[model samples]
Target chain A: MKKFLNDPVNFVDEMLEGIYAAHPMVTYVNDDLRCLVTAKPKAGKVGLTTGGGSGHLPTFLGFVGDGMLDGAAVGGVFQSPSAEQMYQVTKAVDQGVGVLYIYGNYSGDIINFDMAAELADLDGIAVKQVVGNDDVASSIVGEEHKRRGVAGIFFIYKAAGAAAAEGLSLDEVARIADKARMKTRTMGVALSSCVVPEIGHATFSIGEDEMEIGMGIHGEPGISRKKLGAADAVVDEMMERIFNETDYKSGDDVAVLINGLGGTPLEELYILFRRVRQLLDARGVNLKHVWIGEFATSMEMAGASISILHLDEELDRLMAAPANTPFFKHVTG
Target chain B: MKKFLNDPVNFVDEMLEGIYAAHPMVTYVNDDLRCLVTAKPKAGKVGLTTGGGSGHLPTFLGFVGDGMLDGAAVGGVFQSPSAEQMYQVTKAVDQGVGVLYIYGNYSGDIINFDMAAELADLDGIAVKQVVGNDDVASSIVGEEHKRRGVAGIFFIYKAAGAAAAEGLSLDEVARIADKARMKTRTMGVALSSCVVPEIGHATFSIGEDEMEIGMGIHGEPGISRKKLGAADAVVDEMMERIFNETDYKSGDDVAVLINGLGGTPLEELYILFRRVRQLLDARGVNLKHVWIGEFATSMEMAGASISILHLDEELDRLMAAPANTPFFKHVTG
Candidate 1:
């Protein structure tokens, strides 16, 4: 594995230490550095909390800033954080209003976050949850809750965070979060596998000339592994799955997010974005907002994921609203 | 190659087209999609234009937007753009206040940009150029003018772009760019080589357990090729070269930019940044600002470069000013 690390055991902790040293906008809430909360947390606003595995940068922790998550319980690479850690974050970030949890729809995350919600309820902290199930390739239609949440969780964050920032009640924020979760869909194609630091080797392997369509971030099996072909062909397959799986129809508006899975270059993401826009245009789906970069990523995995958020006026406005984070920032509302 | 491209020959143009379809803020000039200019160009302000080879995504063209470059003449991957292209960009963005040129220092770039400067001169437009030579590993201490430019050119961009946005004259903006260019220093390491899409093979090679310290973006030789070491060790070697080769004294305030060449993970970049901050703290250097990401890259090369900009009050303020680009965006000064 060509990774820069000290002790494999300290990979997650050291990465957290690095984040603490790099930005003044974030700080740990307790002795457990894994329990991170935003330093600029807004008072009297409903708290936004998100957490999951660690390899996906700017996803779980990096989004903790203005107009986003107020607290994030960081996990080890591809491993869920503990219920105790999540409870710590919820208690720390909650300021009488309540805390809303938004995280990916993975069994490990669901169990931990649900347990954390129970623990928080015992502490008089009102907790509501909105789980993301955006990766359509992970499950069949009508079984959307079984799908894995990928980069499309970012849309849920935007909707819910903006709602909380607007001083909405926990139910209102959860409503918007669920709306975003329902509207967004994602599909990924991995050209190469990523290594877990502790493992110090690739968790999975594939032929040098092959790519796996709809690969999970943790090297889980994708729908198909085939010889890599033209960019347009790959995007067409992805768009077909997303369109067939989601409720999007003609004349609908969308915010397209082309996420680079770690090792993919920005040039390639734009190349992928080009086809996505064309595909959307041909389908009479209006591309209203475009974000083309690495919002969510695996660790040094060569791939790109296409995430489309079907946008209504409220979601479009909230997502377009100014957001500031170490990784994602938009100045204009 | 597992690169997501249709025709390797159309790599640059397709990436440009993708950019055009994605963001309405940038549009090309004169049917040559290579000549990109900001759609939100500020009239009466000194126009900042930068250009060079493509593949380094945010490096050359992606910087063209509000508070950054007004125009950029793009080139094929790892190749300098033509003098005609630069001249076209200069002429189009010359808003009566004259234009300032800032780009990397290389024989190909200097030759082309200088020729373009002459062409602009004949057109009665004042053109001032700041060629960045900030790579500390490229030359001896006193012979800094012979060094190669890398990611440190971004400091020059932030300074000069802010100065121009402040309505400074071309000369004043160029002066600030020069100051930033002089104070900044960078050093890099390559874990693997990158492929130019059209070339269809790796431009250079290294062993699995090897890393080349101070390697140039286009596979230029570095100071050492030793066994791949820990992140701290790699950073120590890089920091030694930067400090030993520059005039940084104790108690200096500087901004740090740990830029992934292309393929390195954000986690590794942060791990490297942790050591960087520790070293700077030990040396009594105050780390005023921190930027850690892929600001410049070598298409999927596995490596990273560390750039430090020593700041005076004016440069500190200008560098900290809000600048918006498709790649680089800062909402706060």
Candidate 2:
């Protein structure tokens, strides 16, 4: 593939520089650290931060704004940002209000962010952390809490940001973030693998006519391998697993997210949503809201995920709260 | 190429349904009209709105949030949303603070948006419209005012939204938006054409060894065709034109945007930015900010665009103001 770069190693740094240049309202620490902080840190409002490997545009960084994250640390393509980098972002965005750190459930991310939280506490900056493990496909039937977090991270960010905006304490933010995670569940499938710039090749190879179910965002091994199927069938498989994993009964209100894994077109996402609508309706579940697009992505991988957040009246109110960020936004009803 | 839709024509409606399903805080009029309005219409602040076609996910809708756009009229893929749709969004979001109609310079968008403005006036709602004609590519010498707007529309949205969020009046917001457009310029190149869902094929064709300059977002013809060159050379060519078009003086402040046309990666964008930085530094221009991503895309077309906005103190202040949206957010410094 034709590409632009002098050295593969410099790709992430250069992109960060470009981002910092275009958005003066956004600041960064160690260029090598890949830690980005918002220009405005709301004093007295709990700070929320997230970081992960790069490549998913607008997920971590894009969520930093008036009612979203306070800072973000971006790692190299598909690699978790370093612990030190997360620590710096945590420090930068800290404004007397304690900080809440949320990120995906990847092993590296968990270790690094956990380390960063500890480091923040040492700085006299109170910090709490929440890991988003919402992927139903990555968990055993009985170990649902260990699932990998996918695009459903947006829900956590929204709920946490709104809580912070409402002057919730750090512990309160973390508590609500955990609640959001509990309400969220995700499942993804991949039809193709992405070519990492530094790696210079596909992370995993798949036959043209094959698809992998429960594929983790960072190209982690999925639960099942099968031939490519229609969009509805794919949606059914993902929704079934996600529904089975999450506890929801008829008449329950839920938020549905049909997220593209970077390469899938809106056309296909819609096709998948059609089936999702049918199945949810049939189950007597009230689909209160929906979002479809490339939210969290795995570079140029072609696939989709279905995420459902079973909502209570409180969760519904929080979800309806106005949110603004680079990659997602909403105004309450 | 593998795709997700059973039928091509169902792209927009299906996508809209998915959006509503996922985001409970947003609503649509005509439900099938593709115009998205925030559920909370009266935020006690002036409402900002934008409209465009589908290919640019997050551009129109992504900008809707706190300190950004209040609503968006999304059209068919790469097609202008109708005037009636724009009118509907305006009516929905007008909280008596008046409404600002911001859009690109396409003839269709202009005509339709104007119709919407007139329709709003008939309903006793104050409305002001500003067109983003920021592309330095499509105009002749001394005719930059006629340039077609490209990705620079985002800058206009940010600046104008900031002003409105600060309680600027309708006319004041319009002026700032116009000022932003005056300082912005964009130029795009296409490495490959995007396959339209309805067509199931590329709207245009280029050879494996070739690319085109000054291409429109919707696979329209470009100003020039040439063999694909190195990433630096390609950026240098784009910069040379954009630099000369802006007449940016030494030590002048400007915001630079290196945007992917949808399919390019960060590796390539950064590679191009590496050269962009060198060229600007050599010219003594102070780079105030940079946004590198698929902020404005044309489906999965593999190409990139460069946008430069000469910043004055006022424009800079507005640019630095906080903004929150789905695809982008600006925090005050």
TM-score of each: 0.99, 0.77
Evaluated on chain A only, model 2 obtains a TM-score of: 0.94
Question: What does candidate 1's lDDT look like per residue over A1-333, in tens digits?
Answer: 788889889999999999999988999876998999988878899998999999999788999988888999999998999999999999999989999999998899999999999999999999999999899889988888799999999999988888888889998999999999999999999999898998888878889889999999788898999999999999999999988866777989999899999998899998899899889888888998888888788899999999999999999888888888888888782
* lDDT by residue (tens digit), candidate 1, B61-100: 8888777789999999989999999999999999988999
Model 2, A144-163: lDDT tens per residue?
66778788998898888888
DockQ of each model against the real complex? 0.85, 0.26
Candidate 2 structure quality by residue, lDDT tens digits, B133-184: 8776688778765777789998998888889888888888899998998888
Model 1: runs farther than 4 Å from truth? Answer: none
Q: After superposition, how far is residue B269 of candidate 2 from its true place, in Å?
A: 4.8
